[model samples]
Target: MGTEGGHGHAIDTSIPSAARMYDWLLGGELNFEADRKACEDLLEIAPSSRELALNNRWFLERVVRFLARERGITQFVDHGSGLPTRPNVHQVAQEVHQGARVAYIDIDPIVIAHGRTSLEVNSGTRFIEASMTDTGRIVEQASKGGFIDFGRPVAALYVSVIHCLKDREEPAAMIRRMREHLAPGSYLVICQLVSDEERVRREVTELMDQGTDGHWGRVREKHDVRRYFDGLSVLAPYLGDVTHWRPDSDLRRPQKSLEWVEFGGVARIR
Candidate 1:
């Protein structure tokens, strides 16, 4: 990602990237004015956008720790892994299982740019700037990169990003392809924006669809999300608002947005 950790690329600050926007929402300093404006617009629609991001992130950290410490997963392939934030996948996993290896996937140039310095923190990490839909490419790169092992259980994290795939893109189908490539006992951790309110779904979907400044999908219902786990052996505390997907502690941040939530859970491939 980003020319192997050296040389800077020209980033078009006029456009807003979802990764940058997310980093901004998390109170990070990796965003531009366009991203800030986009977040403001998003907040106008979903007032609890920041809280929702925080909750999803907390869920991600908690689930990774569980997988590494309890479930014994060491390798990870983060689909659409966004910009580097505090306690990333590798950092969290390594804390539980030292020498945990991770392959970060993202097509965003911004993410690619930052990943060179931020993600490649050790020999245990790698970054691939490719479509998450390209499971074959992901596997090949991860295997050839000499970090991730396909023969071992790998946690493929979709965490909060599937809403970027349009209906015709078939998010569920992409997951099935991932299952085909991954070893059994490997985990598929997924969660994305979902809402029961018809208005929230429509408006938020439309807003993100038009202004994400890149490929984007609609906010769907819970039923639509369940389709992604149709054949997988879902883990305990199964599919629901990720805010409640194993709280890990009562100290977690609260997301008051009933209008929309990051919904889905972890499932294992048999």
Candidate 2:
């Protein structure tokens, strides 16, 4: 178990990982029985877990397209990017502009394995095995490899993964650091599990914390997430449930779950 071809690492199937559980929710097979059981328990809490995952994924695709086509952003850094789902960042961006380059970062060994294999043939893309907070290493590796140019207007994405970060980890501060690293006119795409219900927040946070062996962050309120976008120019309609943020034709029907939602938006770094 080591980093080889950027895919080698010890995978402990005994515990469920947030990335693997997320893959299971999305109907992917990159998960183990532990992950499946965790999802089952998660569904009992958030009955619409699967739907929420799908909506969040759709939001990701739409935002990437907007960045590539309308915003003319050619580079992307997908922080905490999980298992390779269909229409990945590079696929969405490159579809708009074939020259688009993307660097996917994640700490999950399974994600690294799948991402490296799926992206092996794509010269314009690369995967880095590292925590999302290791911004310096990520930028250095991405720039040195020519997979991303820090000098250009790159989009740094933290979609649906911030909930995995504890407060002490300072997710907001991490975003600020990344904001400083990016060039002017760069963008930040963020969203995470947010709930208005205190019960839902507490229970889900506790459940995930236990399920992932304390590798989980607390579920936060919308205002807590809002602080992450403070001082930045939020895109049209402002920060809200991602399902309502620039939805394409395919997302005409909104998700009806009120227990929680992926809350946040895209912001431009001035």
Candidate 3:
């Protein structure tokens, strides 16, 4: 197993991490007690959190398969890739094309540790510990590591993670930076928590911000997320609820959460 943490920071169980909380939501055992408790509190605010997480994960897999099988993309960069889960980006892409290469990027130490162990034997995959905003460094490292070729069409996936960025982070600008780095015809997969109800957006955002110690971003409206794909060619159905984005028959039963939903879609860089 290969595991490397950029800062070598020890895991702190005192603070709740979004990644660990997400793990808890997915019924994964890689989370700490703090994460579990935090998720419990989160569930109180957004009762459908677990359903949202599962649907978003399925959307990620579907898009990756589409890019690999339909678009013939051979390389992928999964930004903010959380703790290793079944049917990871590489696993989904490789199923379509065995030679496909994937680079998983995340700032969570636990994710890096667990990712390295899970991907160690896979020569075509790599786990990088870094902020997704560090597009240049991530692209450079993935290129230098020889797992991802920037010259070819690459799928840059922000899937369900952009909500971790604060307003000052300029998430849209971050997407633009990545788009500038990718080759033409490359794809960008994005989805984040959104709500039409002002109360749901405000309350959920506040709850997550406090629980994660301000490491959370506000739940945005549909229009705000739309700006992230400006000038790019969005895939069919445009931007809407992720649950309906090319759903498979095996998809879990939809959760009745009119409060909020995971929304966004894949777009091709022109």
Best-performing candidate as measured by TM-score: 2
lDDT by residue for model 3 (137-247), tens: 898899995667777788998888888888898999999999888998899998888889898888887877886667788889999999999998999988999889887
Which of the numbered candidates is closest to the native, going by highest lDDT?
A: 2
Candidate 1, 55-114: lDDT as tens digits:
888998999999999999999998888888888989999998888999999877778978
Pitting candidate 1 against candidate 3, the one with the higher TM-score is 3
Against the hidden reference, what TM-scores do the models get? 0.94, 0.95, 0.94
Q: Sort the predicted structures by TM-score, highest score first.
A: 2, 3, 1
Candidate models: Cα lDDT each: 0.83, 0.85, 0.82
Model 1: CA > 4 A from native:
1-10
lDDT of 2 by residue, 1-270 (tens): 001111236778888888888888888888899989988998898887888888888899999999999999999998888888888889999998998989888877888778899975798898888888878898898898566888889999999998888898898999999998899899999899899999889999999888777888888999999999999999897899998898787645467677889999999998
User: What's the CA RMSD for each of the models?
Assistant: 3.5, 3.3, 3.1
Q: Ranking under lDDT, best-scoring first? A: 2, 1, 3
- Identify the runs in model 2 with alpha carbons over 4 angstroms from their true place: 1-8
Error of 1 at 178 (Å): 0.5
Tell me the deviation in Å of residue 134 in model 1: 1.0
Candidate 2 TM-score, true structure as reference: 0.95
